[model samples]
Target: MPEKTIAEFSVKYVQVMDEKGIADAKLMPRLSDKQIIEMYRLMVLAKAFDDKALKLQRQGKIGTYASHRGQEACQIGGVYALGKNDWLFPAFRENAAFIALGFPMHLLYAYWGGDERGAKIPKEFNALPTSIPVGTQLLHAVGTAWAMKLKKKKSATIVFFGDGATSEGDFHEAMNFAGVFKTPTVFLCQNNQYAISVPRSQQTAAETIAQKAIAYGFEGIQVDGNDVFSVYRAASEALKKASMGNGPTLIECFTYRLSDHTTADDAKRYRTEKEVLEWKKKDPIERLRKHLEGKKIWSSRKEKELIDWANEKVEKAVKEFEAMPAPVPDDMFQYLFAAMPRRLREQRDYLEKYVNELRREKNG
Candidate 1:
């Protein structure tokens, strides 16, 4: 038999803006000056929310929370590309994504505070509650996309996960199904370089995470996750292709997690300060700020106004979250079923009575 060449593949890496904040004008996405400013504002809000969440966690105001300190551009940029009717299936650590998609800040605050009510998304938005189990939401996203395809809808679905998720069997299966079915879905993997303490080098052997999509018969693109414009352009293009009935696109966002994995995690144990400092030079918010300044669209006064506005919004959300009524002792059993199961009802009633007794004793 004669040797023959089967196929050759290539992956594209996108970067509209460099670390020095200079952008390739021809590669810039079509966005108004106002919209670009809004992107910066949203990134600021994400950082503000993250800072507050960490403080709240330290003070025992909220439970152990995941912080998206450095990944704001990856989250917000991709999410901002979605249409109103598009759906989002997110893994945890996506606070900025939710905010960019117009989710209420107070609700996100409540969720981090361990309140189940916060997961109940408003009817107008098409987003699922946060999935804590790694790589599991891919199935849900695929199913939603299949449904959209069956119904012949123009909307697409985006699923967000981390580098670690790409190693899961569920991720591979989801990709296969998405390819075979030709579903309108976008797989957005935020490769933040670290899956908790494990580094990206330890996650997989593949040269680039984006190449994983080729096995499933789809195109994958790697973008500068720290550059908001690059991430936004990749996501926007993928979404448009999907809406036009194209199959899935896997976007590998090459970024870093600036903070510890979560409140319970101490990244210093595994990584060095020098490494963190190196990544800090590519900080997304600062890069965008620099870009805006070069265009003369941003000034010291505008910076102050932006920070103050973000602070005000965060403060209002915190107050609302704190002022909300406490969950009833039996509230845990209420959300799962329209009518409680018999055995669950008995347990709930017992807890309710016990809580009442405790209240009565306190009153006396």
Candidate 2:
């Protein structure tokens, strides 16, 4: 037999709305004007939440916090596509997604304020608490999907992680398991150009992160992360396909992290102002606003009203967060185990004595 060429692969890139808010009629998803406006509102609210969180951190109201500034569409669109029954596992920095999923903003603030109780997820949302450890949540998502498959449920699991996580071994392991078992999983990678200080180009040699899915025997897609319509369309199709038992799909949302990696790290040290400026032009919230404006459904008055409403909501949440009782010192160690270990017991006893001594000295 002649040496024949092996199979070839090509990644599909989708963009329904341009930076100028000009939308392609054919590529646009089946969303009503009301739905579009709602999406815009959610995105704006998320941005407002993020801006406030940053200020709070600077004022010592919160601990180290991650910013979701430029990736509003990627976060909101992905979460909006999910059904109420579906499960979602999110890595850290999913503030916008959590907002879209009806997560309590005050609880989110508490979580950032270093209260573990804030992570006690509510029963209403079928979602996991934010996973801080890099790509580990991918495994949790896959496991949930596998369980759902065995139970023969018509629901899929979606996991959100950043580009840096793709480099973790857990990502590939999750991909392999999902591919081989045909689990109902959707892998959403927000390729936000850089992973902390490391650029995506320097992380992997592959042309695109979506292509990695091809190697695992599944389809992969790339989308304009700033375009709400495109991200929602891709996510909706993938989730439905998973529910229908079509296995897994990887969606690479090409977005940018306009803010610093976290409150502790400055983005300016690694990236240039010019690059940030260019990405600002593609701001997800701005683009979505422009789309509504082009449709004559949005006006400056509406924008002002929305802004006032969002700020008021955010301020209320901030007040609630501030009014929250201080975390118990025992909460730091006791919650980790059912029965406190000997070492922990000793540590607790010492802390108690030390606190008592301080109280006595203050009284004296």
Candidate 3:
């Protein structure tokens, strides 16, 4: 037989807004004015959380923290598109997503302060605690989606991970299973350009992360991650498709990491200042603010009010987190199982006695 091409594919790129704040009216999604304002506010609130966390980490009030500085649009826009019944499976650094999903900011603060209770998601919210391992939650999200499908539920599942995770075997396994099972899931890859000093270029030779979905028998789309409208539209469409039994979709959010990887690392050691400066111009909040300004709904006064409101809210959350009672170290042993194992129980008893003896000695 003659050599022939059996199939061909092209990835779609969605960008409803430009860096200068000009939006393509024809491509704009059907979002209400209030929704637009809420989107901007959520992004601002996420930024406030990131800034506060970084400061707290510096002051030793919190452990190492990751800041979602330049990727607010990608996080907030994707998460805001989710319905109440949908479930969110997030990797670490999804502060904007959590805020948009209505996760209490104080609990989030407490989580970073090394208290696992902060991650104890409420029953009403269908969100899992942030997964610290790279790409592992992809499998978890796929499993959840498979369960939803088996139950004939109308809900969908969205999972978020960084660009570097694409190289992990778990990502491929999850994608393969999700495709084969026809699970209602959306794979959201926030291509923030770098994954802990490893640039996206080094992570994969593929031109775009969205294209990876083609091999898994699903549609994939890339969007301007810094453009809130674009990310929202793409995510909304993908989620709707999934819920309607169209199977999974991969949304590659082409964004940037504006801050260092975390409190323990310095970005200055690897990337250049010029590159960082360029991405800063594509600030998601500023772009949305510009669009609001063009619509005559935003002004300097509104900007001040929003900033003041965000600051006040963040301060209140900080106070609540700090004022919470200290956690009992023994409590960790109680939550692991319904009935503690003999070995673990013995270890717990030893720790309790040691702690008590130290306390008594200090008192003496």
Pick by TM-score: which candidate is best?
Answer: 3
Tens digits of lDDT, candidate 1, 1-364: 9999998999999999988875677889999999999999999999999999999898888898999989999999999899888999999999999999878998998998889888788998899989999999999999899999999999899999999999899999999999999999999999999898888999999999999999999999999999999999999999889988988999999999999999999999999999999999999999999999999999999999999999999999999999999976666787768878999999988998999999999999
Task: State which candidate, 1 or 3, has the greater lDDT.
Answer: 1
Residue 347 CA displacement from its true place in model 1, Å: 4.6
- Model 3: pairs clashing at backbone N, Cα or C within 3 Å: none
TM-scores for the candidates = 0.96, 0.95, 0.96
Q: Candidate 1: TM-score?
A: 0.96
Task: For each of the candidates, give the backbone clash count.
Answer: 0, 0, 0
After TM-score superposition, what is the CA distance of residue 130 in candidate 1 from its true location, in Å? 1.0
Tens digit of per-residue lDDT, candidate 2, span 1-364: 9999899999999999888765677888889999999999999899999999999999998999999999999999999999877988999999999999989999999989999878878899888888999999999999999999999999999999999999999999999999999999999999999989999999899999999999999999999999989999999999999999999999999999999999999999999999999999999999989888888999999999999999999999999888888887666675567888999999999998998899899999
Candidate 3 similarity to native, TM-score? 0.96
User: Lowest-scoring 10 consecutive residues by lDDT in candidate 3?
Assistant: 328-337
lDDT of 3 by residue, 5-70 (tens): 999999999889987665577889999989999999999989988999999998999998989999
> Cα miss at 215, model 3 (Å)?
0.8
Ten consecutive residues with minimal summed lDDT in candidate 2?
A: 328-337
Q: Give Cα distance to truth, residue 151, candidate 1, Å.
A: 0.4
